[model samples]
Target: MSYDEQGYGNRDSGGRGDDAYSTLGGTRQTRTRLPEGDPGAPHGRRPARNTRSLVMAAGVVVLLVAAIAFANLGGGDNNKATDSGAPGSSRSDTTGGTAPTAPTGTDPVTGKIGSIASGFAHDEQGAQSAAANYAVALGSVGMFEKSKRDVILNAVIAPSQIEHFRSTLDEAYSAPFFKNVGLNEDGTTPSGFTFVSRTTPIGTKVTSSSAEVTTVEVWCTGLIGLAGEGSTKPVSDGWFTITMELSWIDGGWKAVTHSQKDGPAPVSGDTRASSADEIAGAVNGFGGFTYAR
Candidate 1:
């Protein structure tokens, strides 16, 4: 028979008669007890059956107390339910969404590249790519040549601010500055010396950003010197931060204005300097990259 049918049959038969003894393999069993009020009854008191019932009841009570204690001790699903209702929980009560907040503290040179880039459109990756390319162009050897400088300026600067940028830069790279950097008045390199002026952006960051504009700061360390034998100003290194006010125009992020300042630089370590020829070759051979988020 099916289990349900068997259960129904047992219920119909009660705990006695054929159902109980038949389930135990046909063994006939009987309860041995004295008839009530019989003088021949042993011990004359039924030896207190209530004691066994009392012990069983005590065990059940102890188990119930242990279960309650376990629940209060932060065990099982009950504890989880209680914790969810606790005051001042970080978990959201409504949508349970947590938006990211702005980063704090003084920005570092290397990490700033990524942060600033993230403020542009197309997410962090787009910003990083723009920052990296901009850093390369800004720190390039092209800044010395008029034609290359014009090309770089046109490519990176916003259209509205191009004229201002050109005028300011033209004045800054005047004859005296060229001569000081070991170049001719026309910004040509002298014989036997390689004029080195390159900026390598270690990182990028966006302190603040929006759809129309992004305030990006590129932290860069660069090499700016004249590399050659008998050169008065040999190669030197510097750390600086470049803050670019960028605007989204013509499907790209372009700098509307830019300014730079000296850095939180550390002390230089004592190390053997490379030869002029080595530095020149390295600068010429190495190629820059387009960075991303």
Candidate 2:
């Protein structure tokens, strides 16, 4: 049974259920859509806005605790003398005060091929750029559609592995799995809810390098599930790292294989959760971008 094929779920294999994810695991675009011009939003373990405050507050507590502990340790002439000489003694002390220069350069090639971004340059950076964008396409809600899934697979996956990849993926996103994730048997949203699956790259790093083949690890944050009241999976978010092995094929890098594992995720922020309708509206209304560099 296929994603678009009606009879595929009829198979008797019984779906993978919760075990499906045991196997597995970017941009996405400008802001013509959101009036705020924010393509997406961020909520860290604490609100990023309050990070300074959190740091300051934590610092004060540590200082107070340190003072009490130090007094208990002893009244200290030697410690005072040591402290007076400690500053400017270590190399780290002087160097830490200086800011290192950060390298600046042009962003990698970025544009679109059909609905997804394409035209990546031919280099390590290009492969990384390609991998980041490909990850976004693969993880999107659009991949649930057979045609779009095929298009995406064709665009990024090596031609030889396409069939095997599709078959395994189809099985992985099976009917039972869909039901668990709040999707219908066919992976569509129920009435009054909008399905949202989006991947935004946190960063990319080249793990292995070669002229023709390279591997890049993309740290990303994703949002998934239906957005509506009473929805069990109401747009939950998580962190994932996608490791893509790419080959320079036909003058461009294409993914030969990819794998994923759980994060490196951040603390979920203290930001108030948005309403289901609000989440639905944001998912539908905001647009993703073509990531590069």
Candidate 3:
């Protein structure tokens, strides 16, 4: 069994069906392929074999010619040409080759919030970036460090809820929880281990928005744990839905209240697990973004 990029198990990746599939979370028989044999074996005799072979050969030649023509006409490396229209390309108009026009007529309060929201601003492509950065700010890391935490909370949360969020999170980042996640009492990374706690938003939606408030829900899947040697609780992914009640206040959309719930999660897959070093390097190398709806 193997997991695809989407985290779903692919039975085709090799494994006996008797073994339980990880994604399905149960034992399931694998589908078997029929052994190769002559299609006319069951018939009395083969008919017109040479004619069929000649047709197939001609088809192959035609395909080869077309491929070569395409390769030459594309005027670039074949791989580069294919990759040019991939999802990450900003200019690639995958939505039927038409560029998305900018939205017109912004709300005044929303625009004010948009100003500070600019720090957290991102287009749809940047949703994951926003989620990851916001999650880091909302997580234990932001609460442990005094100045950093203050800035994060002040910038991200609603003015009215700032005090409450700070007080609650302060207690949540107690010594025991820090130790549990392989962090120091003060929430710093332990010796030889890089503590990992980041969220990646799957998608976001604005459920409702009024003059003074916006109700946005960010569906996120996060990676949490320490990545390093001698670590038992290595990094693992989690799925959660975070609902935020944001208020247009003091020139920004501030989170008045937020809550999270587990899942909409998919089954685990059989992909080869990446090493701690790989995970650590990937996280460090990638930069997060701010999201806007």
Per-model lDDT:
0.46, 0.53, 0.42
Query: What's the lDDT for residue 21 in model 2?
Result: 14
- TM-score list, all predictions: 0.57, 0.64, 0.55
Query: Candidate 3: misplaced stretches above 4 Å?
Result: 1-136
Q: Cα lDDT for residue 226, model 3?
A: 73
Estimate, for each residue in 99-194, the C-alpha lDDT of model 2 and write its tens digit.
332333866455666677777776556776788888777767766666777787777776766776677555555676566566788867799888
Cα deviation in Å at residue 279, candidate 1? 1.9
Ranking by TM-score: 2, 1, 3
Model 2 Cα shift for residue 61 (angstroms): 39
Error of 1 at 212 (Å): 2.0
Candidate 3 minimal-lDDT segment of 10 residues = 1-10
Candidate 2, residue 98: Cα displacement in angstroms equals 18
Clashes of each: 16, 5, 5
On the 0 to 100 scale, the lDDT of residue 175 in model 2 is 70
Q: Which ten residues in a row have the lowest lDDT in candidate 1?
A: 1-10
